[model samples]
Target: MLNSVYNKKQKPSTAGETTQSNKSWWKEGILYQIYLQSFKDTDGDGFGDLNGVVEKLDYLKSIGITMVWITPFLESPMVDNGYDVSDYKAIHPRYGTMEDFDRMIYGLHEREIKFVLDMVVNHSSDQHKWFKGASSSRDNEYYDYYHWWPAEKGEPPYRHSLFDPEGGWDYVEAVDAYYLHTFTGNQPDLNWENPKVRQEVYDIMKFWAEKGVDGFRMDAFQFVSKDTTWPEFPEGHEKDYVKWYGLRPELHGYLNEMYNKIIGKYNVFAVAEGTGSTFEDAHNLVDSDRNELQMAYHFDAVNLSQTPKGYSLLDFKGVFSKWDNAFSEKGWLAIYLSNHDNARLVSRFGNDSDDFRTVSTQLLNTFLMSMRGTPYLYYGDEIGMTNIDMPNIEEYTDIEAQGKYQSALKAGADMEEFINTLNYNSRENGRTPMQWDASENAGFTTGDPWRRVNPNYTEINVAKQKTDPNSVLSHFKRMTEVRKKNPVLVYGDYTLLLPEHEQVYAFARELDEDKILVLLNFSESESEIELVELQGLTSEKVVIDNYEGTAVEGTCITLRPYQAILFSLG
Candidate 1:
């Protein structure tokens, strides 16, 4: 057994700065992403609501999460699982009233946990008042709130919409104009270049901050800017749409202006969901100058897959290199393997065996938490949650999944192949209700859940794992403790070790004179390490271990399947 050290008086190196500092509270915090509809159902309405989340505050506290990023609960038509917001200020009736949202904010602050709301400013539901008004007449004052154009004689703006089966152009017969929807036709992309639109968004953000929300998770942030000319790509098989501008040069200017005008007023955290962003793009967005966002989530590591379209089996080397290069001393990365938009990490990376599944999940948690950035945990992940393999299209709640299914059929994809793709890539995997117990409806509610609960909830749930010290839940608790107790784990420089090892993943985190080594066996087989390589370190201590009975010898250490070990060095 390893003895632990608690440095109570050790002041954090980045302490005493403004709470909004990119290097302050955020650096040491752990963020929990709550897919609101699946967390808890308080009104017995069969859907999780803000009040339901408030009722479960103790559960979040017990897990030691410092920040909570709630998926959008705004008024919507449910077209995109709350991503297509119809009203930014009003909470959906199904989720609860604004009062319920306010109560949640107050409760979180009282518990010292920051509340971050999802800001889906890139697009709005076509049913939104603004979009409805814009579509009513071409010359309406609100017309500029969305992208509208006259259909060109020869070609449409772009080929079929990525999220629409009908294509990119939506003919609004009411105004005799065509609108552009980068996503679904029901979700018209917002016209960010419009000054009035910009102000409205800024004011909306300020309203939330003033109402006591601590931060905002800017969703689809890179999609806010588009090419001025709306140029079309040449006919070819190229994924890179250079002429179709994204992360435009003007993006930084707009972001800085918004930050200063709305976000700068209160000490609030801002993390951009920078999907499809290059390393250089991330650097510009998160650099310590306080000009752009405090931090940004990168998808490079998560995008590693065998398939050209979506995620695939684990490719450890590819993931490590992406993370190692994307993060820097001046900027931070939001380390996450799964979120409400993607499949669960265990299902994506593990070998599909129950025991190995648990081990692999714990391994991912340990490796991610031990790295040099703030870590975000999706709900139910700590308990080794699996993906929901819904059988039919009607069982799906995500708009993207349904749209893609239609496209697959139109593109001549066979029914079997299309079903296989949906099984692996549907957002339903992450939207499953929390598995609280083995009872009917997984004990998340007496009423039916909005989505299906994982069928394995009986064997894998909080109630069962809470009593088992060796379970994945316990491992997660221990990992959180490790992060809080070690500064090097939170603010240190990260260096990857054994880049070429196929089965073993190793890395060292160094902060001044303190160094910590984290090693993991990614496979089900035992791994052997040469003892001499680790002997050069000055001081040593075993801080954490996933394998309970394993013994570490001087020169060599043996790691059981999916085992992770953390060692301290002076």
Candidate 2:
């Protein structure tokens, strides 16, 4: 019955259709993510601001980014890089004023680029007026705005949290209650069960919509709806918060309520951070007729490959093929390899060795751009940026990275090796200042950056790549050019080619008579493209290639190490 309600009332009827006229910008457009603090800084500030993004509108437009998703630059304590919102209505002073935000939005619109702001509604900073007021006394008007358990009765109920120094619950002496925080103790989870709190979030969305901002990327969205009964984690599952702790039943109803109130009314899309979402949950969240989220960043596809241990091509194909089949006729997925929350793709998921770094990244980029659903490119990712070797924990500024390091130390793990792992896997990898040029601080800032710029910026930067046709940034620009001209890339039937390959990830996207095949050699060893699987669909036109010359030789296509070539099939 619930599925029926979601399907009949909310899911878009056009999802099953493989036509070019999907009429949804979210499914067709390219979404570029901007980690605002690391993007660019003006006024000599150590951190980047909204005004800094305004200055880069032309560059973004030139790169063919259709929409921009700006990370949380709202007023925050910076405990979680702006995820802990202290004020929903105000901009962080360090990131500039409300007027600067207005300018950035207008400038993006001027460049024909839609803007999506990070909507961190799952939790708020403990310093927020509402949270502060709620903790002050039980009699306060905002006392029920957050989740707090009275400790006077008994020990606070046991639950899992992704962030808590000691445990999930933090005791407050002022009110003799333990407040819940899905993240850090300073960030308390909001009570979505409370109608008033939900209304406040809706009002916040309305305000931003009225300001002409396009959409919201819901952060930690799965945790917003909890059981509230204070259920314990199942036996043998104590600290695994990501799996057993999210996607409660109440979440769907609440999201539906929010969708009807704001997103549906405003004609703007909402893409949820679907870290914990299962296949059915993802379908329920983004299925067109479902009246819920428009798209989601499902990690099942990327996680299979984005790790320091390396990944197999079969694993990569399996994950994406699973999603491709799951959302084929109903929901939508966000095609992204890197974002502000994860490590750099080239250094993590990709082979960033000297011989393969550029071409390997180009191959990955080609695969991402040619995939079904929208593609999201994180800042600095287009220029083949690799993770920086942050040798010391003292140089790290990410709260989660620090917390993980402290946890590792307490666990008595090797500190040196742990730091190495952090450098390879930390979210700070993606937070490094954007490599704009060969200037000091990579032209991101004249002043010292809030985070260190990657040292490879001198060779890998927008300014250098803009003129080099074979550069990764140029490859990205060319891929977008191809994507923009091909509707099949946006709304087409995806068929995995050579799924059992050991070092190649190839696939074809088809819409009616028009089809394009994407072939990627994910190895540093030269390989041959197996044409037997391609059947009679021969390469009609070479759309793009990372290497200069063609490798097609009759029935067998010889691919250079990490080479990628897209062909228009006849």
Candidate 3:
């Protein structure tokens, strides 16, 4: 619990929306990602469903989240969670009926919250009807729906999967052929080269848009296009499948076509999840003039340069700085440190200890809200949710986690060391149940939860934070309100002030006469920052600081542990 007293009177409205850009609502509003199955469960089935999400629209609204991205709940075989879609248009039975989804969309509209459904176009569930037919025989009409290699060859090309040791090629004994699966064997990759396949995807998109969904968050969309030839890597770069197989020239044309067919026609928010994207890909996919996508998220900051000890902030600076300069003119980037595929932010980057948890979480929020992009907040991130270390590997339900655990044991890795890695890097860290209150199951459900709730729910639940102004949730609400009110924060020129600084992340955002300086202490100990460069500016005010009554005295301020302050300078 936050012991420091906070002033709620200084907070603005509880909605993070603005008319900052005439471009669209998607650009002007903040986005929050919710893994719906772990969000809430109303059916007492221990699983979160569409009905449960409909029940929590007000909670999202309370947190000032204007746009919500719900992860896939579409019909699936429950292999890779819901990512292995069996039906693109229908809701899963465990989730709820399609009518329930319609009601949830309507509920979101009632709150003026934009709804974005997860669109997984990279692949489909191996049990999907089309795949079923494709694997049945090459003579079937759906034979070309998936990527299948010749059975006569005995073995398909060796395609590597970062997720599994068997790689991306999975043999189908029924067809005596190999089908590509970038993920698990249960999820086979689709053949985007097929025009009919593309058309089928478009029709699915049309189904949701016609039903009044606000947007689509395409999952691993960059992998949709790849060279059809499975060429063996000329040695030494075999694991470079992600880079060589992605960002093909054909992808831009496919995106442009999709943009024109659905996104442009509906004027809907569209962002691709390009995990291995580069700045050049960013420019090609999202530059406004290209008419491809509104924006796309890359994994440079989240996956690359990370180690067991921890991630390097210096490398983080390099990644963000690269994208900032790349998208400074025409394109837009997404500002997020963690998502469904990664661990919790506080657990990954900030100190989650009791002494510094609150301030560190606030500091992370400050960076997220003040940055020049659509800030994406994970469901529980708003309340500073930390990672949970499950007692055993069996308790982890995420497919990737299970795969890694089994693979590690096979490799003779130390059990304790492997568990430590899972503790720090598992995707299941983000899929834990949302802590709504201090009650049983964190008030997410009366029945058993699909996943174990973080035991810290007693101190970190929303019920406790809603009324406490100093709570992490309260700080997020205030920061969101600030971003909504300040247009410069959304549309402004950004400059890195202390790129080489070890413990402090300092930057400035300026738009004409309106300028603001952001200073973030990224460590858990106090430090004195002497802003000699800021001395040139005499007239400035400390507009937003997590600490109460923080002052900017004579260009030198003693920043408390994890303190974040914004000074308005003209």
TM-score of each: 0.92, 0.94, 0.93
lDDT of 2 by residue, 247-341 (tens): 88788888888877887666478888874646877777776667778786787755664436777778888888888888787767789888887
Clashing pairs in 3: none
Rank list by TM-score: 2, 3, 1
Worst 10 residues of 1 by lDDT: 1-10
Q: Which stretches of candidate 2 lie over 4 Å from their true place?
A: 1-21, 238-240, 275-277, 305-307, 533-540
Task: Summarize candidate 3's per-residue lDDT along 373-487 as a digit string, tens digits.
Answer: 8888898888999988774787887778777777777779898988877878888888899999999999988898888899999998899999998989999998988898887
| Candidate 1: residue 40 lDDT (0-100) | 87
CA shift of 17, model 1, Å: 8.5
Candidate 3 regions exceeding 4 Å error are: 1-22, 236-238, 275-277, 304-308, 410-415, 532-540
RMSD, every candidate, angstroms: 5.1, 4.8, 6.2
Off by over 4 Å in 1: 1-22, 151-155, 236-238, 241-245, 275-277, 306-315, 531-533, 536-540
Index of the highest-TM-score prediction? 2
